[model samples]
Target: MSSTQVLNHSPFRLEGDFISQLLTNIRTRSISWTSFVKAGCLSNENMSVLKSITSVNDQEDPLSRVDVLIKDIPTYSKVLFDSILELSNNNTKNLDLTKILLVILYDGLTYINSELFESTITDEFFKISKGNPYPPFIEILNSTTSNSNNDDENNQDNFIISILTAHILTSLLTTVPAQQPASSLDLVSLLFKYIQINLITSNKLQYRFLGIQLLKELLSIKSFRNIYISHTEYLDSLINIMLDKNIELQMRYLSIYCLWTLTFDSKTSQLLTTNAKYSEIIPSMFKFANDAVKEKVVRLSISILINFLNTSINSTNKNEIIKKFLLTNGLTIIKNLIERKWSDDELKEDLNSLYELLNDSIKSLTNFDEYENEIKTKHLLWSPCHKNTEFWYDNIDKFKENNWKLLKSLVSLLSDSSIGDSNLTQLYINQSIICYDLSMIIKVAPEVIKIINTMGTKTQIMTLMNSPNSNVKYEALRTTQLLVANSL
Candidate 1:
């Protein structure tokens, strides 16, 4: 059959018939195939089987043909890779040929043994040309539109190529060495960009799932994980995918699974707990676990939260993470999850462990611990401690601990500009509460005015004093009056 005839069939038909035709053509004329056979990479029996399949209609079992090819997958992958490069370099937009080559490569890799896979695919496949911004595969990926209509052949072809490429690359990374040279970094960046454009942004569930799967694979390497965490935009994109209510349950589960893998590294866990943008992961996981209908989704989300809570480098960091979880009503979520009957005994065990951890955290917290937690989380509000006069009196001296750690956090919150719009009322309440607490601190211990002044807390309060909101303006005015009255 002509390549065009092969291209015209359905994908399932294409898989068997198309591969049979391509292998026959390669065996007869391809230099890569000639070299592999000359090197005796394939046994005589396998070679005889390959030699027999000259026609697409050959009655050889498809699994038998696959077994023969997988035994020498490196040679087959190289041949397919060269074909793809040639087609791409010629600017041949034969979507059928490209998709077929990618599908064969993808399937070959999928079926190959792990040992052979690791040995066959390496950094050489991932190299980028210094003259060109993207590798050829990436160029094709960028050239395609992500139209969702299946009737659009070109778009569908592009989508298939993308998914296959993602799967193929993920498999290739299994044996590809980590900490590659700087030249290959462009490929990493381009791959991430492609995923963001095609997979993460695509409406198709298959695309999103493969995208996250590819992400998980990329993150398996330490170097790639570092690069990933350094780019907060991508990190935020990942978190958004996990939190998207419109996303399917499996996709969300995969996204959290990616996170669960990431938190295995201490530095990543630290960033998740500390970075304002990434820290939203805590609340997102809690909410997902609370609402997820699938047992595995809830299990994975809780596992991630537990990782965050347990992976802290210090007690202060641990406490801050625990406090953030509790502030988001994580305790309530955990309790509820504990009440549900889970088929997985491990999940039930995890729920019980998480509930105990949160309870222990709560039991150990003094009023001051609660107040400090609120300050550190930048989520201040009129909890009882904020309104209690005696609480402030007792804790005013403790703010000096850790060189005024709690006080510094409060000042930092006062200066923050990126507080999101979704919580505008809460923002107002938080700022108002901070102002009230600062005034009470000034009243209880006038000496803290020096520390507050040096940190420019006064200026931020003055800015708040001009607010149009009556409560914020009033609280800011009250705090400013105290600062002035207590001035040294």
Candidate 2:
């Protein structure tokens, strides 16, 4: 019933080989150079079957027909994955190539066998890896422009390059082993550089489509999210393009996708507020998503707000409400160290470090003294229920419930990550948490006294303040005096 569960089911639904065959067929025709491409493996018998269903010519409808053929793909490639990339390099100039690439990247993802997916077909289209001449798709597109007239070729060149880049990225997502960060990081880095340079310099409506491709690819990595944050300028271009009237919906959707990736990175959360352009830009997100762009942009905005909320320790009351909703809904990931799968001590040790980190994070959050009261009351959040809520105190129970669950989720992450820690390490980690807690208590103690009138006068306090550690007591006394003076 949840949105992710519902959304995930469809993407992973198609059969592996069937999807592969579709991808292969598309690739074969995608290249304008390849006259050798066949109708499809089953085209001889199914030619009539395919023709009746599609209303256009063989070339025009291949991409669209393939889309239809895929609903039943599970029947074919659910056994026949080899067929996906079997198409030759001729798939170079296909106009609708972008469509098929997205289809494979989206649907074929679920069925791909990691070993076969990676070893057989990954760089075949782009030819990037040196071992096999897996040159990137960019090179392939650039090659097309060589023999063409400059005037006529420009738009088509932009189209082909953008489409190819999109497909290349789609292939990466569809095939890359989701679990391996180390193997994937290098390619992701290369992709970020490609997208940044190509999309930024061109400013062409069609070229902006690469923004979506890059966003989807980068998000899949999850580990190298930092790379996204460091490149703030590229991100600004996306926010700007999202609103450009001349920009196509294709590119706008792509820009929206890019915005969602920005949400996952912590650094950019602040950039949304600190960067002057973002003040108005961020608000416009609500208007941008309607029935059309709604699912992508709306979910993206929620995800972005959650990132900002998660990073805030002393954020306003409204922040608490937002953070609470996100946590309750399982939007944030709590790091965990589940050991059911393996007994390796090394693995356990790594998990322990992860646990320590969770504790440190939780403690930091617990002790967060907070933010300005006025701002807490002023900032507003749009609610999925209807109009956005202007005041969080109006929904205190929801906030408290979410806060409680947030702590519980931290416990889960810690438990999952605690596999290797010996008692000593855990004890040491716990000590750090205790120290952090002391700091938190120290921060709020004076405020507590001011509210309760619990503190005695300084002279009365000094009479009883005989301590071995005079310096410690002196500091405490000085702190209390400052609190009292400020209260007055």
Candidate 3:
């Protein structure tokens, strides 16, 4: 059995309510303001402010008092901030209060005096040491734990505090200049982990929603775009969320919104064109735009597609992207979208622009260009040109260019094992198309058979002859027969 299968049967698996139960247990515990004052973590005046906010007799909402504290006595923000740092240092005895203090800090920072608080918080929160690469709050998050049940509880408490601290830092980072923190640390990876842990690992919808919101906010910062673009794993994670059928509609919309934000950067847009892995996003966006019932989701999907075309670094990249789009029937989808009565003017404008762009691309694309792009993308289908005798006769020699680059791509596609069982139909179609194309090439130029056999294309074709799909087996047999006849 695989390691994943073993892990699935592990006895120490987390319960569905793990985070919920942790929060409930933490909330049941309380801390007195007097303890903080005595420890010098909170000044007497700061303690007074806390008392007023938590006062039982006060008719006003505590949040209102928090707003007043930050506005009238901006120094109180520092007092609360300092108390949090101090309490976090002795976290074993003060974890509960540190969480409460972090809540207050998050609220206060929303109305923070940028002149007084920005530089100070930025320096303190991101302060690094030779011993540790993470910030202090992230240090708490990285704390190690064993399998002991008691230690698990302690670890859970630390995790709760770390998440709260991350939120507070997020609030501060959004308001201040993001470049300093972004450059100082691997902020992209850190934020990606934050989102992944909450959204993917946890079962709670609220946490998942909050994760998407955090991603949206961070992507709004331009400094982080290049770093984000470089990590295909990060992009893949967001794309999975956006494409997941089980995810909430709003969450998926927000996830795509994050992708839209990244496309505003030219480098990310170009990466989508050149990288095969990232290029898969083009078809996904097209399908989502075609199927989504929500106007906002459709609007954002179209907007991202427009950005991809507009931001393409050069004509080659632009045409590559456009070909992928067309392979997914993007032009038909755009035409239907343009005919709809969209209430959003911006959506209408985007639809028209995308329509024109796709039309222009269609005018410039040759039959061979489309065929070559399909091979490059490895997304084979029986397009009209695939069976056209004229197309095969005209383009058979073109595949030999660049030292038979197109034929090599075909061989690679036939050899791919990554297509999962769920896509058996697609796998069969792709295999059939490749076998038929190889047979056509062998018939047109028998001399290329020596080259094709050396490239192991025959081995892949012979394997496909055992497939359950009749079409695949038939095409594979026909191709193998051609190879045999030509070799003799």
Worst 10 residues of 1 by lDDT: 5-14
Candidate 3 RMSD computed on C-alpha atoms after optimal superposition onto the true structure: 9.2
Relative to the unseen true structure, what is the C-alpha lDDT of residue 297 in candidate 3, on a scale of 0 to 100? Answer: 87
Q: Model 3, which residues run further than 4 Å from truth?
A: 1-48, 56-76, 91-93, 107-151, 178-209, 420-424
Per-model clash counts, in order, read 0, 28, 0
Candidate 2 steric clashes = 28
> Which candidate order results from sorting by TM-score in descending order?
3, 1, 2
RMSD of each: 9.6, 19.1, 9.2
Better of 1 and 2 by lDDT: 1
Per-model TM-score on C-alpha atoms:
0.66, 0.40, 0.78
How do all the candidates rank in terms of lDDT, highest first? Answer: 3, 1, 2
lDDT of each: 0.66, 0.41, 0.67
> Could you tell me which 10 consecutive residues in candidate 2 have the lowest summed lDDT?
366-375
**Who wins the TM-score comparison?**
3
